[model samples]
Target chain A: MLTLAQAQTIMSAALAHAGTAGFKPLAIAILDSRGAQKLFAAQDGTSLKRGEIALGKAHGAVAMGLGSRALHKVALERPYFVDAATHAVGGSLVPVPGGVLIRDASGALLGAIGISGDTSDNDEAAAVAGIAAAGLVSDTGA
Target chain B: MLTLAQAQTIMSAALAHAGTAGFKPLAIAILDSRGAQKLFAAQDGTSLKRGEIALGKAHGAVAMGLGSRALHKVALERPYFVDAATHAVGGSLVPVPGGVLIRDASGALLGAIGISGDTSDNDEAAAVAGIAAAGLVSDTGA
Candidate 1:
């Protein structure tokens, strides 16, 4: 289980990295392996839809059991497949980068973190930083 | 359509009201009449699912063309009806007091606002105050 405290830590570190890196105000979401929300936050200046985008990234990762970086490649290669998956997931799947799976040192999946409000690569970097801060491994599906 | 500025004003005022009233930390969501998100924010320390609950409240109100207050009554009078409505809305409908319709002074619908993280009545109060702060009318369906 992904503890709430751990989820908060991931969010804080992710936001901190975003601030330090001069990224746009971000929205972040953490979801446990079961696709339940663990924590979510949207910075003051985030656009209206950023929150959903963030949730989608994380939810898609957990639902498909693949980090969104891999999903992105699949989306390019098989748009219809990803489209069907999105429908299967209740339309919460966002096939893109910036969604990273969280795993313990034992390589057990714990949860995922999704970030929006910057380029996909930069968002993924922040997710990586946050997971590292919690002493967890990040799988960007690369 | 609800502008981002208006939505933020509503959220800030609602949060301020909650703070002054000693309510718990809140999660707020605003959806335009078209059911598109306008804003969402969850205070630190909120429970994991509060964000989705907030969104559900607002989305349900927008989907049904009535305040969640009325939906609550419908739920009590006919549970199965509310259940069907919930499914029809993709499971976002949350029939409760905290979901309110936003309208102009002339009674034209503009959007909806929903709040979670406190008693349902208290949540409704905050949503009302937020809409008023934005110079909009609130229809609680009471």
Candidate 2:
């Protein structure tokens, strides 16, 4: 099970990395395997939209069982599927670069992290840092 | 304003209440003033459907600026309005008994909490317990 403590650790590390990297204010969301959010935070100056977008991305990651980067690739290959998925998830599917799945040492699916409010690449970098700091593996590339 | 920490505290309390009341496993969702999810949790053994339903209820609470119970009353009085709302919010409006608005000390709107998995009354009870535990007032009665 993905504990709330671990989820908080991941979000804290993500925010710290975003600040250190001088990225724009960010919103981050963490969701468990059931696609239920465990934690979420939007920086003071970030647009309110960031929170929903972050949630959409994280929900998509868990729903598809793939990192959003991978989903982005799939979206590129089958654009129509994106529309279908967005409708299927009640407009919560966001195929983007900042959603990553977390796995335990046994490769058990723990949850996912979604980041927004900066460039997708930078947001993803922060998420990766957070997952690593939490001693979890991220399924971004694989 | 409801900080992410406060949101987490509310959700934790709600789940605890559910456990104490011997309700079925549940999914709880907390939404910010902008109707964005602040935190969510699905207790183990709950169906995945609980996640979306929880979100819908929370979104409905925020959208209508009333607790789900009040919204349900409104729905009963104006069924057509409920249909319109379902279309307007991208179908996230669930005029049921598990959503409650959270407010700060100054009576400012903070957000809303939504819970699902048990009977509607039980879900609302848990939400009320959670809002109280967070030291925030709930507009559930109003």
Which one is best on DockQ? 2
Note the Cα lDDT for every prediction shown. 0.87, 0.84
Q: Score residue B32 of candidate 1 by CA lDDT.
A: 81
True contacts kept of 2: 0.35
B1, model 1: CA deviation in Å? 1.1
lDDT of 2: 0.84
Q: Give model 2's DockQ, 2 decimals.
A: 0.30
How many residue pairs clash (N, CA or C atoms closer than 3 angstroms) in each of the candidate models, in the order given? 0, 0
Model 2 ranges with Cα > 4 A deviation: A1-9, A12-24, A32-44, A59-66, A70-96, A106-111
Expressed as tens digits, the lDDT of each residue in B1-142 for candidate 2 is 5787788778778888888889998878888898866667666666747778888889998988888888898899999999998898789988989888999888899999888899999999999899899999888744
Segments of candidate 1 deviating more than 4 angstroms: A1-54, A62-67, A73-91, A100-142
Clashing pairs in 1: none
Per-residue CA lDDT of candidate 1, range B54-133, in tens?
Answer: 98999999999999999999999999999999998899999999999999989988899989999999999999999999
